[model samples]
Target: MTALAAEAVRHDRELVARHAYGDPEAFDEVYARFSGLVFQIARRMSGDDALAEDLSQEIFLRIFRHLRGYQGRSSLKTWVYRVAINCCRSRLARRSRRERAFVAVEEGRLERVPSAAEGPQGRLRRREAAETVGRALNRLPLAFREAVVLRDVCGLSYEEIATVAGVRLGTVRSRIARGRDRLRLELERGSS
Candidate 1:
């Protein structure tokens, strides 16, 4: 790690320790630092804003509840991400508990509405495109899906993805690449 990266990790470790000790300010700072990332992960992975909000709340609750058990083996960011992804996985499993009797599905929603500029046909085209891409993403394997979402949707670095996924850097790279390739195949198959 660079000097600044090392310092930030050290600072985050302290913050996590302080929170474990019931320091309210430390908890607040940690929340402030990571809530956005947590929320975005939940939101993107779950595909429902309302559900994402609830998932975000659950992620924070789990974080606070398990603060004392944190060993700092990974950075606070990585730990938090692990929790967020697990929560999302659970929520998704429960939500789609049928055909997917026992599997993880992080099917994200395309919740964008084209502006007034899109008119009618354009809006239809946009919706179809979003659904097509969303389905392709959803078809990825769980490992690939999580890696791609963290790297592409959450904008996390490959190193961060590796830490969060508890995998090696090369694994992260392979997962993302394979996920994109699978997504491309799915989309092409759908369009045909």
Candidate 2:
């Protein structure tokens, strides 16, 4: 492993130990270590950068508040993910009553379209395809999207995803399968 990887692993171990022993510095270290991951997950789930930032902060705050209740039943990383998913779910629930308005603005569009002068039309096509996939992901129901993101984007194993999602292992597999199927259909519609 690289020096950086080795250092990170060592730091994670030390921080976990110190936090378990009630060290405030260790809590700060944990926050710094996992905040980016939390933020990324939040952004993917909410599809809004501003809301994601707010949700990420709320997730970490909950983690700190509930740290004492952590029983080491799962890895700390998985537990952190569980908290993030719950935070995203709560945010989605609270917003469900409001109609989501999408503004038709140029800046909101993904920068995938190329100028007519660009010779590599294929590259532009690929970017458009990727943007389509992103849009389809954003449209999926929160539960399905969470499963897809956790299993595919974050590359978590099925067992880990099940634990983090608080679902049975079989349910995690089923949801991932169904989510992929739905996304594929959406992509096909977009392409046609």
Candidate 3:
């Protein structure tokens, strides 16, 4: 790791140690650092604003409750993401595939307020593109979807994804490749 990265890992360890020791401000610091990342991952993975909000809360609750067991085996960011992804996967697994599909379909119907700068046509185009991507992601197998979303949406390194997903590095690469291929096919089918 670079000097900066090593510093970050050390800092993460100290923060976790503080939180585990009941430092009043440590958890708040943790929340301030990770809340946006957690929420964005939830939103992109779940594709529903309201559900994302709920998942964000649940993720933090899990983080708050389980903060003590964190051994600092990985970067705190990686550990937190692992927890967030696992939580999302569990919630999604409980719903029937048909239910997930229905929700994904319904997601496209929700409206958003457009930026004044974008104008109506720009807003329409942006919405359509987002729907297309979301639909394609939803159609992907869980493993592939998780890998692709982690890599593309969450911007994690390949090694980081392998750690978070508990898979081999090769497995992560294969999943991302296959997932992108499937996503490309889906988008092409949609466009044509």
Candidate 4:
């Protein structure tokens, strides 16, 4: 096996052992491993970096608190993702009721773009496309957005996604199909 793959397997075993033994350090390892995944899901769902950071922290806190209750029905990673998604959903619901604007950037002069190893023009186009996609994702309905983010961005299988979203497998598949179709239409419209 590849070195990275071997390392991942070792880490997974270590985490399970530590968690099962109630080792706090083992929980910290779990947090370090999955924190980025949590943050990205939170950021995508909330469309606000600050909110995402807060939600990521909250998810980790919940995971630490509930680690003992985890029954190992699903993978530990999937359980953590479920917690993150639920936390993001709760924050979204609260923010929707309050009608808060989730601006991604502050009002100021344009920031310097990253140095483009692919060339300036290609980089500009790529950046514009990314921004458009981000906006389109943010415009989607919360359920659809979460489906796409978990499936596409996080690369979760339909079964894993179903577990994370607390939905049936069929529902997860339908939502992902519809979400991709909607996003395609939005992108086509924007391009045209």
Candidate 5:
């Protein structure tokens, strides 16, 4: 490994050690740092806020279960992301089997208590765009969608993504490239 990569691995080892052996507070600190990232991955992958929240909570539960024994062969983020992705995949598969297939809730179709952070109009537009992109994303095959989310939205390095995906570096590159192209086409077509 490169020096930088080695340093990252060392850091993750130390952090995991701290969480495993230190006071309970150390685990809380780890949770605080990773929860948002976990939530983001869940939300983007599942395209459902409520489901994403549930998944995030479930992810944390799993993390706490396994964090104590992390082997440190990969960075902590990659390991957590792998867990998040696996959770999402299982949830999606179960949902699909339960129903014929999953369907996205239409944009602004969700009833919300109004918030002043942005006017209702602004929120609507943003929601619509998000819905459009999400619908487009959902149309992608899971492999392509995951590669896109992991690299583009979640911002993992190609090497990290390979570790998470259990694929080679070249495969990660191809998936990301193909995913981006598919996304572009979907956006232009405006229907999935």
Candidate 6:
């Protein structure tokens, strides 16, 4: 690691230690630093604003409860990411099962009528494009989705993703490639 990178890892270790030792502000600092990241990951993985908010709360609670047990093997960021991803995956599994048993009333949505405030066609096109991509992302398999989200959305390096996912570095690269290819295909199919 470069000197600056090493220093960052060391700082994260110290932060975890401080939190474990009951430094009252340590966790608040952590929350301030990572809350946005956690929410972004939750929002992308779950594809719902309200569910993302709830998942973010659960992730913070888990971090608080398990902070003392943190091993300091990885940076605190990677550890928190793994925790968040695991929680979201588990919750999604439960939700999938429950949803399979019932038909959702909100499954179909009405088309929006352009109002005076939505004046520009370009802006409306961008919104539609983003929604299409979001739907394609939601269709990805769990492993691919996680890999893509960590790398593409959360912007983690391949090495960091390997560490977080407990997989080999090559596996991370391969998953990312395949995930991206699948995502592109999904997007193309949607456009068709």
lDDT tens digits by residue: candidate 6, 48-88: 89999999999999999898888767778889999999889
Across 107-157, the per-residue lDDT of candidate 1 in tens digits comes to 333233333356668777777666656545655556788888998888889
Please list the Cα RMSD from the true structure of every candidate, rounded to 1 decimal place: 5.2, 5.5, 4.6, 5.9, 5.9, 4.5
lDDT string, candidate 4, 1-192, tens digits: 578756755666667768878787888788788888988898889888998888888988888777767765666687788888888888888886666354323212222333335565876867876666776787677889999999888999998899889999999989999998987776766555
User: What's the lDDT of the predicted structure labeled candidate 6?
Assistant: 0.81
Top-scoring candidate (lDDT): 3
What are the runs in model 5 whose C-alpha is more than 4 Å off? 1-8, 99-131
lDDT of 2: 0.78
State which candidate, 1 or 3, has the greater TM-score: 3
Q: Tell me the whole-model lDDT of each prediction, alpha carbons only.
A: 0.77, 0.78, 0.83, 0.78, 0.79, 0.81
Name the candidate that leads on TM-score: 3
> Between prediction 2 and prediction 5, which has the larger lDDT?
5
Output the lDDT of residue 12, model 2. 57
Please list all clashing residue pairs in model 3, or write none if there are none. none
TM-score order of candidates, top first: 3, 6, 2, 4, 5, 1
On lDDT, the stronger of 1 and 4 is: 4
Which candidate, 1 or 5, would have the higher TM-score against the true structure? 5
TM-score each candidate. Answer: 0.73, 0.78, 0.82, 0.77, 0.76, 0.81
lDDT of 3 by residue, 10-120 (tens): 898888889888997999999999999999888878777898999999999999988888886777899999999999999877753548667666544433333335765
After superposition, candidate 1 runs with Cα above 4 Å error:
99-136, 190-192
Candidate 3: list runs displaced more than 4 Å.
97-128
What lDDT is reached at residue 179 by model 4? 90
Comparing candidate 1 with candidate 2, which one achieves the higher lDDT? 2
Q: Given candidate 4, what's the lDDT at residue 168?
A: 96
